[model samples]
Target: MPATPAWPPKSAPRLFVADVLSAGLAVRIEGNPAHYLARVMRVAPGDVVILCDDVTGEWAARVSDVGKRDVVVEIAELLRPREAVPDLWLCPALLKKDRFDLILEKATELGTARIQPLITRRCVADKLNLERARAITTEAAEQCARTALPELNEPVKLDALLAGWPEDRALFFADENGGEPAAQAFAASKGSPAAILTGPEGGFDDAERAAIRAHPQARPITLGPRILRGETAAIAALAAWMAISGDW
Candidate 1:
């Protein structure tokens, strides 16, 4: 027998929908996606779409009808079950639109339970559109075969985030001048429910650093010797945390 090929070929596209999504899903594709499918992809009646509900996992649906304004697909059987996301939360400072967008997409693939956009004094881009960010993560989850979606918290100032920090969940702040290396610190901590914080272009300010350090949950750790970009730091920290303490 031949090896089974991946469900989605390189040419195929997939999407994530809301929960309890089974057959006969009234897919109302609007905006750019609608245009792309109707005009570019040239999908018509009987065309297929790969879908996941972030609950029941993924499915294969076929287009039942196509209109000048919209398109619809008949939901098929549930293909895969819900993915088990890690208990790790990613608290990365806002970077440029493109960089932050990339971080959100990759973090979703890496199994982050939640994503928090932090506001630091050095943060170049403090304003984040929650709707857009959520959309990005949702799409990412579908593409990466993840059934569960990462929670996106509203933008919070560094102080506010630390002040309301949960007692049991340790906050692992990635510091250049640090307490210990990530691997060593994480190994010693025994996978304590953690949220990894990475700052923006200028990194955390003096007062902000002090406040976070003072928190009971704060565990300062170093990434490496080389100076990394804010975006690089965020994803790197997430990767290390996931390996040491998160879902493999």
Candidate 2:
């Protein structure tokens, strides 16, 4: 006899649904997601589609019908609970649009609990479309099979961020000028709430660096000897921190 087909086959298309999914509930997917399912994936009745609500985690659903403007699915069972994300925030100075977009994507995939965009004097870009940023993060999370979404905050001035800094959280400042080794610093602060602050493409200026250093919670740490671009530094530092403090 042929081997049994896998339940909720690995080839199933996955999606993040807005509604809280439970067993036996029918959900109609509309708008862009509906279009993608109908046109791009060509999902048909009986096809398995993995759904996540960000709250209830992953669910296996079977497409019940396909209409011109919508695709309906019935939630069959809960597959996996939402993932536990580390209490790590990524606070990076804004880079160009394309570069910052990359940071948002990777940060979400890497399990960043939150993302705080900083606007500094040297920042190449100051404005960020919150909707677009969320979209980028959501897409990344879906692609990476993340059950939780990272909180994306509005872009704030460096000074404002410093002023509103939480006391309990340690701020791991990735200072290009130098300080402690990143991995060691992260390991030392393991089990505490932490945020990684990286500079813009132009890097932090003298005054900004001094202000950040003066912050009580800021602990400056160097990434490495070679200078890294703003986006590269953000991702590299987060990856290192994840290896040290996250679910790695």
Candidate 3:
């Protein structure tokens, strides 16, 4: 006989729901998500739909009802528990709208525990739409099949962020002027709670840089010899840290 098909087939349409999923729970997906499932994916009764609640975990659900503006799925069984992401945060100075959006999407895909946007003297953009930002992260998480979403915090001024910095978490500053190599620094602080801070377009002003360096938990690190753009630095630093110290 042929081998049995896998439960929650890989081709199933995955979605992150707002409800706390449980066995036999009926989930009603509405609005945009409903349109994607009902019209885009054209899911019908008995079709398999993968759901994640962020709080609980991943689950296998079967479509029980379909409507013009909604689709209901009955949770079948839990596939896996919410993943344990690294205790790493990405604190990047606000860049342009499109650039910062990239940072948010890539950070979520790379498994950042939290994203703390910073407002520095050199920052071109100081405001972030939390709702839209959260949407970007949520979409990225779904595309990457991540069970848990990254904590997206509102943009805070650089000084305020430094003042309220946690005592235990190490803050790795991506200083363009130069400092310790990123790989070496990350390796040394492996298995510790850490956060990487990258500057904005023109980089941090002199006073801001000095203040950051003066922080007790701050460790200035260099990406390489060449200077990187705001978005590039954040993404590069995160990728390198994940490869070296993260759960990769």
Candidate 4:
């Protein structure tokens, strides 16, 4: 028996969006990510890689040309179909760029159905660029070999979020203030669509917390005894739910 080649290969294949990927497919490297893959990682022709368009699932690709200024890869074949993501959404308050970026990447790898960036009163960054966030998650998905990209929604205010929230789906909110243990809440939510809500850096104001708690579908869940950073709380909470009530 021989060792099978890695699904993504160890060559650090990059993703691209172009029609018709086959042997001898030519791809142009642009943007910082492409530059980094070409220059930093030192990818060369004949190196196996991965490519995906938000349209189809991931494909197996290989570098056809190692340009001095740009790197081009040819798509070989379709490796896998679009992945089946969970039916859960992560509604997390906006954190600093790096933290939010990490959350998007990790959440994509963990297979969250959707990511809604919430704008609460205490949120440090009021505005979030949807394009950048999508890119972050897209690259992460491609790297993680995910077939489907998680929907990255525009930033919505906390009040508006609570008012227009879907009533049928259960909402598990982290009450930096106090609430039921996460495991218990998630166990009770088995077989139901749910969303995890985490507050911003400064946490939620009293009125904001009250509003979330007032919702009939809302249930406050605890991370633990100690406090968690806004981003950390969101990721940990969702991971717990995925294990308990989701497809983990």
Candidate 5:
């Protein structure tokens, strides 16, 4: 006989829902998610769909009803518990809209525990749409098969951010002027509460740099010899950190 098909097949569409999922619970998905399932994916009754409630983790659900504007699925079984993300946070200076969006999406995929947008003297953009930002992260998480979502934070001025900096957490500053190598510094500080701070396109102003360096928790780190754009630095630094100190 042929081998049995896998539960929650790999091809099944994945989504993040607001409801706390439990076995046998009937979940009513509406709005955009419903449209995606019923119209885009063409899911019908008996179809298996992967659902994740940021709180309870991932589950296998069987489609029970489908309507023009909604899709209902009954939770079947838990696939995986919510994952424990690294304690590292990405504190990147807000760049242009598209650039910042890339940072948010990639950061979620790389598994940063939190994202704290910074407003520096040289930053071209200082505002973020939390709703749109959350949607980008949610979609990225679903695409990456992540069971938990990263904590998205509002943008704060550089001074305000530093003022409230936690004493226990290390802040790795990506300085264009140069400092300790990123890989080496990250390796030495593994398994600690940490955050990476990358500057904007124009880079941090002298006073801003001084202020950051003067912080007790700051550790200036260099990405490499070449200069990187705001978005590139944030993404590169995050990837390196994840491989060195974060869960890879």
Candidate 6:
């Protein structure tokens, strides 16, 4: 006989739902997600869709009802439990709107457990739209097939962030002036909760550098001789850390 078609198929549309999902429970999806399924994807009754709750994990669901503004999916089976992200947090200085958005999206994909935007004196943008930011990270998680969403934090001033730094967590400061090698520093902090702190385009001022250096939890590291953009430094540091930390 011919090979049996894979159940639910790999082509099924995936989404992250906010409600808790249980097997055989019908889920009513509305708002943007519902519109995407009913209008964009043209999902109809009996169509397979993958749903992740971020809390309970991922599930396979079949569309039970499709309406103009909403779609109902009946949860079928659990795919996998929520993933355990690395204990690394990304503390990047806020750049321009577009640049910061890029950092948020890429950081989520890179498996950072949390994102703490820093408001340095050199930062181009300080205020962030929490709703929009969460949406970006949510979309990124969906696109990357990530079951767990990284916690997005409000922008905190650099001074306050250092002042309240957790003693158990090491803060790796990417200093343009140079410090320990980035790779070596990451290796030393392996298996411990860590955070990478990068400066803005203008980079941290002498006072800010001194403040960070004096913080008990801060460990300065060098990204190399070449200057890097704010966004580049954040993404590069996160990628390097993930590679060594085995989150890659």
Model 5: worst 10 consecutive residues (lDDT sum): 118-127
Winner of 2 and 4 under TM-score = 2
Residue pairs in candidate 1 whose N, alpha carbon or C atoms collide under 3 angstroms: 23-75, 24-75
Between which residue pairs do clashes occur in model 5?
none
In model 5, what lDDT does residue 15 have?
Answer: 99
What are the per-residue Cα lDDT tens digits for candidate 6 across 111-221? 999999899888878799989999999999999899999999999998789889889999999999999999999998899999999888889999999999998888999
Each prediction's RMSD over C-alphas, in Å, is 2.7, 1.0, 1.0, 3.2, 1.0, 1.0
**Candidate No. with top lDDT:** 3
Worst 10 residues of 1 by lDDT: 5-14
Q: After superposition, how far is residue 215 of candidate 6 from its true place, in Å?
A: 0.4
Deviation in angstroms for 3 in model 4?
8.8
What is the C-alpha local distance difference test score of each model?
0.82, 0.94, 0.96, 0.82, 0.95, 0.92
lDDT of 2: 0.94
Stretches > 4 Å off in candidate 5: none
Candidate 1 on 1-248: residue-level lDDT in tens?
A: 99896654445557776546866666676666667678888887877777777777877777887778777777876677877777889999999899999999989888999998998898888799998999899878766767789989999998888888898998888987776898888777765677889888887888888888888899998998988888898888888877887776
Off by over 4 Å in 1: 1-12
* lDDT, residue 220, model 6: 94
Give all TM-scores, in the order shown: 0.89, 0.97, 0.97, 0.83, 0.97, 0.97
The TM-score of candidate 5 is 0.97
Clashes of each: 2, 0, 0, 0, 0, 0
Deviation of model 6 at 81, angstroms: 1.2
How many clashes does the backbone of model 5 have? 0
TM-score of decoy 2: 0.97
Off by over 4 Å in 4: 1-9, 16-29, 33-38, 41-46, 64-72
- For residue 161, model 3's alpha carbon misses the true position, in angstroms, by 0.4
lDDT of 2 by residue, 1-248 (tens): 99999988998888888999999999999998899899999999999999999898999999999999999999999999999899999999999999999999999989999999999999988899998899899889889888999999999999999999999999999999999999999999999999999999899999999999999999999999999998999999999999988889
Clashing residue pairs found in predicted model 4: none
CA error at residue 58 for candidate 3, angstroms: 0.4
